[model samples]
Target: MYQRILVPVDDSDTSRQALLEATRFCHNQHGKIRLAHVINLAQFTWGGAEFVDVGELQGNLRQSGRTVLEKAAALMQENGVEAETTLIEIWGGTISSAIIEDATNWPADIVVMGSHGWTGLDHLLLGSVAEGVVRHAPVPVLIIPIKRKK
Candidate 1:
């Protein structure tokens, strides 16, 4: 049970917390992890001729994503969890979609991730990626949420 765990990581405290939780979950069994980082290219508006500096900006995003994945992988290693990393770049899609697609392809037993646990105005403004994952994920999702600071 839960032999293949998929974790979506970012450079947030909640994301790190999720990674740690996944590490703990995989420590006892013959479990392995696939760490995923999704980058949304649509957030950037690249205009002007020659595509402006779009390529450079995209490169930066990829680098940043790679760094995040690397750190997550290192954390898993520190906890003695076997983990691999994948980066998904989408020009016009939701992060949750990318995550679910990967989870399905990897055939993960579960998805362990961290959520901001936003609510009220914050939830409305930021929207919840974890909520989307919980709604549509092919595998069971374990969301580790960080408390909101006042």
Candidate 2:
């Protein structure tokens, strides 16, 4: 029985599945759902560019994050889950840290996320975001792997 279930989503199918699962669990248990999307600041890396203004990048990323969260919210609504969505676009931080911070601050009862993202080689080189979150998250985390067509 979860009170506040938090699901971190992106523009990926696996993330969408995580949302579906979280919503189903919350709906059955009469719990509230929190849909969260963290726009990683490192996504705009320009290979040692000197004039990287943190403020400008954060502004752009914030808008993008909001757009992503809006779609997730729409999906939740379609599934009959009235979720309270949160868009956190922090500057100069790791995705795992951003997620962990939100989970701690929001005090979510559970965290559900996709096992991996769109990053292919990068994930292999730098490890997976879901893995990182699970390693550092203070609360319970459930990782759902992206379903690939056979």
Candidate 3:
């Protein structure tokens, strides 16, 4: 029985699906959930230089991450599952690395997350975070793939 389930969320349909799946799993196992959202401030930095005062941008990103975490936590609560939320700031690493580190440090039994399922040129350009987590996570990771609605 996977008791401690860690879920990483973003503002995406796939993430929503992941949350739903995590909630269902917890409900069945009587487990707890740790919801996390990572804010990658480095994305705002362009060309390896500080182009602007990123303090405000970083603050905004933090707020957004909090919002994402809150919404995920709420979903868990609404499903009658215990949930703890964390907002991770990626000051010096990739988002996937932050998520993997959090999962190891939190010592979760399993990780549930969403996969954008990018392929071909898009996959090469965007580089899948789910792929990174699958490759490096300390625990078993369940990836829920989401398809775009046409």
Candidate 4:
């Protein structure tokens, strides 16, 4: 039923699983996949260290984001799914917020993402982006949980 699928990817096993699920779903529906990576410049600038050049750091972050998107797109292509990529620069916003915004702007039929599955104290401290996206996204969200190794 989904025509345009939006998948947010990062350099994590959870994200990889999410992409795999998105690929399978898109392949079944003959849908296109949009892979997005958001770079939050605020993370690199919060300390405001004089030694670090913000511009250079942002450039490097953008490059890394591009690489992540490229690899995810390549994987989708290998799975016989059409894929598109986007790199978003965030000055001040949570990653979940950016993803939700992209979903709305892209007008995606659904959002597919991975959950880190943090619970208890870790969940409280770090917060969950997947949870936030599920709460705020305008479109349907499919969360693929990352299996923890015993």
Candidate 5:
């Protein structure tokens, strides 16, 4: 019984579907869920060093993370699941690292997230956070992937 579920969310449709799935699981299992939104400050600095305002850019990113988390939490509420949320600002390491860290610290029973299911060039270029998590996370991971048509 996975009582504590940690879910990573973004603004993507895949993420929304993952949340919905998690909500259903939680409702069925009487579990709790934590929604996480990560802001990669490490990626931001190099990109912003030349032109963007560091403080403003970071602030905007933080707000965006909050907004995403809020929306996710709302969705959970609508599904009759009360979800806790955290906004993680990572100065280093990949997004997967942040998620895994939280999962360990929170001691979640499992991690539920979304996967874009990119292949070939797209997978090579974008890399897969879900893959990284599946390989390294201490607990079980459930990924809600994009639906394929028959």
Candidate 6:
């Protein structure tokens, strides 16, 4: 019974699954889907060289981000789901804050996202973005773990 659904996506396969799931849910509930992709400026920028030209690189990455959003939007369209999408370029920091900011600012009813399924050392070392979002989000959060095939 979700009205306005929010799904944060990246270029990862897990995010892709989230998109698909959000689309299906939107179709079932006749809700509007808000697809968002946050571009972390630090991660998107190239480092190492002090004198290296980064303007072109940043521009290209922004363009690529747009393409990704368009692609996701196309998937929703093909599935006969009406959706509105936004691409946000934010400074690199904790993803939790960024996600929470979007949820609060956009005033999303619920957040639907896919867990990266980190385990063992990776889980401990990197922690979980999904978990952070769940803990900090003002609204309900639905985290879908990617089904790994054996």
Q: For all the candidates, what are their Cα RMSDs to the real structure?
A: 2.0, 3.0, 2.0, 1.3, 1.5, 2.0
Please give the CA lDDT of all the candidate structures: 0.90, 0.83, 0.88, 0.91, 0.91, 0.82
| Model 3 lowest lDDT segment of ten | 46-55
| TM-score, structure 3 vs. true | 0.90
Model 6 residue pairs with clashes: none
What TM-score goes with each of the models?
0.91, 0.83, 0.90, 0.94, 0.94, 0.88
- Please give, for residues 79-135, the per-residue lDDT of candidate 4 as tens digits: 888798999998897999999999999989999999999999999999999999999
**Candidate 5: lDDT of 25?**
74
How many Å off is the CA of 85 in candidate 5? Answer: 0.3
User: Among these predicted structures, which one has the highest lDDT?
Assistant: 5
Worst 10 residues of 6 by lDDT: 44-53
Candidate 5 all-Cα RMSD: 1.5
Per-residue alpha-carbon lDDT of model 6 for 1-150, expressed as tens digits?
Answer: 888888887777888888888877777566888888777667635466356656666777788888888888888888888778887877777776787888888778999999999999999999988999999899999998988989
lDDT of 3 by residue, 76-123 (tens): 788778789998887667889998999999989999999999999999
lDDT of 1 at 45: 64
Regions more than 4 Å wrong, model 2: 41-57, 117-122
Off by over 4 Å in 1: 45-51, 147-150
Candidate 4 whole-model C-alpha lDDT, 0 to 1: 0.91
Per-residue alpha-carbon lDDT of model 1 for 35-103, expressed as tens digits? 999998766664452656776778899999999999999989898887999999998879998999999
Give the per-residue lDDT of model 2 (tens digit) for 20-56.
8888786646788888888766666657535787668
Largest TM-score belongs to which candidate?
4
Output the lDDT of residue 81, model 6.
Answer: 84
Error of 2 at 51 (Å): 7.7
Clashing pairs in 5: none
Supply the global lDDT for candidate 2: 0.83
Number of backbone-clashing residue pairs for each candidate, in the order shown: 0, 0, 0, 0, 0, 0
Task: For candidate 4, report its TM-score.
Answer: 0.94
